[model samples]
Target: MAAARRRNSHVQRQRACADSLAEFVERSPSSFHAAAAVADHLASAGFARVEERDEWPAEPGDYVLLRDGAVVAWRIPEEIDDTAPFAIVGAHTDSPGFRLKPSPDRVAHGWRQLAVEVYGGPLLNSWLDRELRLAGRVSLTDGSTRLVQTGAIARIPQLAVHLDRQVNSEGLKLDPQLHTAPVTGPENGPDARSIIAAAAGVEAEDLVAWDLALADTQAPAFLGSDETMLAAGRLDNLVSVHAAMRAIVDTVPSGVIPVIAAFDHEEVGSGTRSGAAGPLLEQVIDRIQDARAVSPSHRARALGASWCVSSDVGHSIHPNYPERHDDGARPIAGGGPILKVNANQRYASDARGAALWAGVCSNAGVTTQPFVSRNSIPCGSTIGPITATRLGVSTVDVGIPILSMHSAREVCAIADAHALERALAVFLAGGWPEHA
Candidate 1:
């Protein structure tokens, strides 16, 4: 009876975690919104929001730094010193989608459309026939940026099956320039700028430029017989982002500092100023050290002793395409979180990192598995290698297994996501025997 009660308790906790994750994803339609959402979660948990130009608090406490669409949050232990190591949880805020192009209003065949540039490698076929929401930050003439998210106002309708009967067998083909433009309404309707400005509660003329994306209008839901499956948009990385945010918010730092780095532009190769490849994470680390009166040399020692868990979604063994995965690399949904491995440095995970993850998961009482892509199918990379190379931190890549990774909507096991959260919480709290 005790074992059964424990199982019931775990199920309830996992369900609650899934619900919380869904709420996080629903509020984050774009990278900017994701950053704000993370900030909100951290602030609610007593983290002070520190600006880049302002001085960070030197005393030990929880702090968060927001940089445009990216955010770097940390927890400083009461006994933190110059040589204190950091257990960092890194994830990206951006996902594969269509970005609204400048002067995006278009008219063709008496139909008004919005021109959108492909931001990342999205499954184009899944985006068709779905209502899309316009979301992102718009720059105003007053030199301020405001996030705007309009309701379902546009759609990329696919060619009817009667017109293209061969689509099922031959596969649907989409042209990003021609066929991917989302139709809004009749050509006589309001322009894109006007509608977007209205959403931002500003006049059209006041809005100068913007960074917008078209997001799926569908809200995340729990599916499957027992409601253990999570279906949502942006699960490719938002799941990891929410996990990191929740973990850091609840963690009380021990000997090591806990940092959550959610950067933008990961899907576009993380080249932007707020991306993992840029100076945001590095600068945040240095700033934290500087505020604590740590010298550059001591900071280097801390960096060398630090560990980063690069969290992103990994592929699950698809039922219809089992051949795409290796024989032993059968990462399944509902099993647990995955430790992504790539021998060619595509992933940052090494033997030592794996052991570190094993120890963390063991302490957290969460089961974990391994994931490696087949030899023929090249594995995609995330912010892991970038963070490892840029900061010289011992990094390990880990994430929950999911299906339809870059689709308009993705699915994952709720238990897996919850397991990831539990493990991340343990890692952020310095559950690994020692800080180093």
Candidate 2:
């Protein structure tokens, strides 16, 4: 059984990682498409779909739903007499990328163009000198809508090497407004009309609204000679979401009610209705109250008994930028999942939660790593802190250590995918003590 589990984990990890990167690239420019992909997966797993307004009261059963690309799914144990304690694993689906505003149109000289705003803190240098395409959601004249990722819309013209002789020595400075505008065509070029026509599915004159941004068409691939590393786009939190899904699916049926949530807009701080810091999770929990009209007292008791794991991405120790990391707490790519800590309470992991997570790693036979920001340096946070406090549940923040977090393309150890799955499975299967 042990060997078989290991073997199965290996296969599952490979398939999950590959599928994750592909989905990440395909569903860019909006979390809506990303959520749709997750909905498809849950549907395939025998989970039934439920609408919030429908008269059929939600009972103790597997249910899933998506909102503007954010997803929340749960399984209600068959024997639930009232509100059962939730074993929840949460991750965000959105990554740092440029977003097209409603009025994306602008004309320069004779060329038509689209305007975009930087969505999150992205590595400006990594975006240079790459083939760029446009993608996102588009609302039509009718009530129905569609996602448009037709093809490469345009490319931000890079300064010529000859114009700047000392280009390599001087590095680069990016003016988002001046240099980032992709040139779709010559002034009044034929390509301009073609792009507008393709986006609207009608003549250029009939187009109403479009939200499009640049994307690299290259597919994700396994990195390193031993294939122990994975390289692809949007690893910030999608990697965590993918790992949580694998873990929940693996251990959900072991008499524990496993829940996996992929919320949108974490990059901009989760302060929205569909964000992790919002009521979507609580609403889903409320839906589980149909079979036994759960009261406020019972709900509080269930919440106190619940456990949550907020999954996000952590910065791996970069070889070239060794000085940027703490000397004693360098998390390597293949090290394992990281237990993030913050003295100022940026991360959700506290002493009690850390110990519980440590035990999960031990039981799963996976190594564990630690991540703490340097005392002198400021720190970045994740959905962990928000979800913990918002839901009022005992929570820990964890993630796969990766390089180039929040960039269009990020790198991570391939083996960490399997390691995270192992740890999360142990967590969902339950045995950890409760905390206040």
Candidate 3:
């Protein structure tokens, strides 16, 4: 009976994680919304807000910082010293999609369309014929901003099969300049900005400028025979964001400080002010050290002792295209979390880091898999290497294995969400023997 109850409890936890992830993605349509949602979650968990312009406090407590489209939240133990190391989980809040331009009013042949630029590397063809919604922050003439979401307001229709008879054999080829624009309405219909203004509860004339993106209107759903898989948009990085947030919220405090660094602009090489390559994480860490009045030498030592888990999604093996993956290291969808390693340094996971992560998973009673891109195909990079190089800290790259990454929608095992969260919670709880 006890064994059965334990198994049932595990299943319940997994279901809870999956349900929470679905709600999180539904609430976060753009990076700005994602950051805002994260901030709200932290606030509900009793984390106090800290503004960049204000002086920080030395007393240990839960605090959060928010940038334009980024958020950093940390927990300081009541009894912390200069030698205390930070246990950081790094994730990105942004995903690949289309961003609306400043002057988006365009009419082609009686059809009103919105001018948009590709924000990151996306599977352009996947966006064709999908209903799209606009969501983001809109700046008003009064210097105030409001969030907006116009549901199912636009669509990018694909060329009919009759027009492109050989499309199936030739494969769909799209030109960003010509084929990627989404039609919003007829020439005589309402202007795009007006629609956005209405959704934001403001007048069109009161809108000074706006930052917006096109997002999928389809709601996330569970798939597979047993409904064991989740299909959703923006799963690549948002999954990591949600997992890291849950870990921090659920884990009890220990000697080490647990931090979540969810940055924006990672989809475009992370070069912006709110991105991982920028000064956000470094600035926050410096301020923490300053607030605690740690000596320079002690700060350096603490940093050297710190470790980061760079959480991002990796590719799961596709049965139809088995050759695309490494023969020895293809991860399956239903498997537990994956440890991504690239000898070329695309990922920062070295032998030591890998071992550390493996130990953490073991302690959590969660299985793990390995992922390495085929040598013939070049691997992609993540925030792991960037954080390690910039902060001089040891880092490991880890994530839930996913399929259809960078597409209008993506897929992953529902169980893996709980697995990744459990492992991260263990790490945050100081499961690492060496660190302990």
Candidate 4:
């Protein structure tokens, strides 16, 4: 009876997480917004902002820092008679969408709309027939920043079915310049600067470099008659990022090393200086050691003791194309966090690390699942392998199973958020099973 009650309570917790994640995405217009929002969450949880400047003593404690709109946080354990290992959780803040290009002042048929280029992998068809809005940061010549927010525009007119009689028989094909183009009336009237100026409370000509993307006008909502599913935009990895940040904050107060990394540019390959594949994390670790006044020898030891969990979206069994998934290893929505694996080293999960994750779930009493691609199909990857290799730490790749991954809007079971959070809480608090 007690176990059942506990499970039910956990479910409620997960439901709250899903709602919070949706809210996060709704507010985070771009990666910059996402990182800022995450920083706020960490601050609210009592983590002092860690800054990078020069060398200093590093010790174990709770810390949060950001690099070019990417956030990374961690909790340094107080019971560090020995070097404490990091319970790292990572996710990307960027999602698939179109970015506004400079000098997008073109008008065709007396319609004025900004020019945009696709960023990351996205389902071009889903974006065709929906109301869209624009939001992002714009840089000023004075070395200051401003935000540009455009109201909902239904300018991207999709082709009607009546115009294409064989639409149902043949799949939809979209052209970036044609089908996805937005119609803004009278381009001759104003330029990109003017559109940005209206939003920034400044003159249009003052607008400099801008980073903007189209977003679905529809807010996230619960789906299904029973409300078992949650639908929202940018859930591909944002869900994981939100959960991990929360779990890390919640665990850090317990005096544990809770590290949360929100890397930038994952969708386009994480090779940028601010990305997970770069030296940002390593540099942060060094700063922590110096801040704590730890010696060089101890810093090396502390690093060796750390562990990482790379959080990203894993493929859920798609109902429309079940054959694309591995029959023996399918992850279902609402089934709990999925452990991703690949023999080609796409994901960082090895048999040993996989067992550790299972242990963490078991200890937390959080239900767990697995995801493996079919032998014939290639697997997509996350930062797990990259981080593990860079730091020489044992890493596990895990995430909530999501449908329509890389789509403009993604879906996932409402209950899985809590499962991942609970499991992460356990892992962050308990340290490694062998040491425990």
Consecutive 10-residue window with the lowest summed lDDT within model 3: 427-436
> What CA RMSD would you report for each candidate?
1.1, 3.0, 1.1, 2.4
Per-candidate TM equals 0.98, 0.90, 0.98, 0.93
Model 4, C-alpha of 240: deviation from truth (Å): 0.7
lDDT of 2 at 214: 63
Which runs of model 3 end up more than 4 angstroms from their true locations?
A: none
Candidate 2, residues 1-436: lDDT per residue as tens digits? 9999998877676666665655654655457666777777778887788776765344566667877658987777666644457788898878777776666666788766666688778776677666666666566666556676656666666789898778789888788777676666665654543565586576665556664556666567776666667777777777777777656666744434678889988888987888987888878776665435778888888788788988888889889989888888999988899999998889989988889898888888888899988787777888888888887888898888998887778888877876887788788777454442
lDDT of 3 by residue, 1-436 (tens): 9999998898888888999999999999999999999999989999999999999989988999999889999998888878888999999999998999999888999999989999889999889899999998899999888788888989999999999999999898899989999998889988887888899998889998888999999999999677889999999899999998889998885768899999999999998889999999999999999999999999999998888999999999999999999999989988999999998999999999989999999999999999999989988899999999999999999998999999999999988998999999998877885733
Backbone atom clashes (below 3 Å) for every candidate = 0, 4, 0, 23
- CA RMSD (A), model 2: 3.0
The count of backbone overlaps in candidate 2 is: 4
Error at 45, model 3, angstroms? 0.9
- Cα lDDT for residue 358, candidate 1: 91
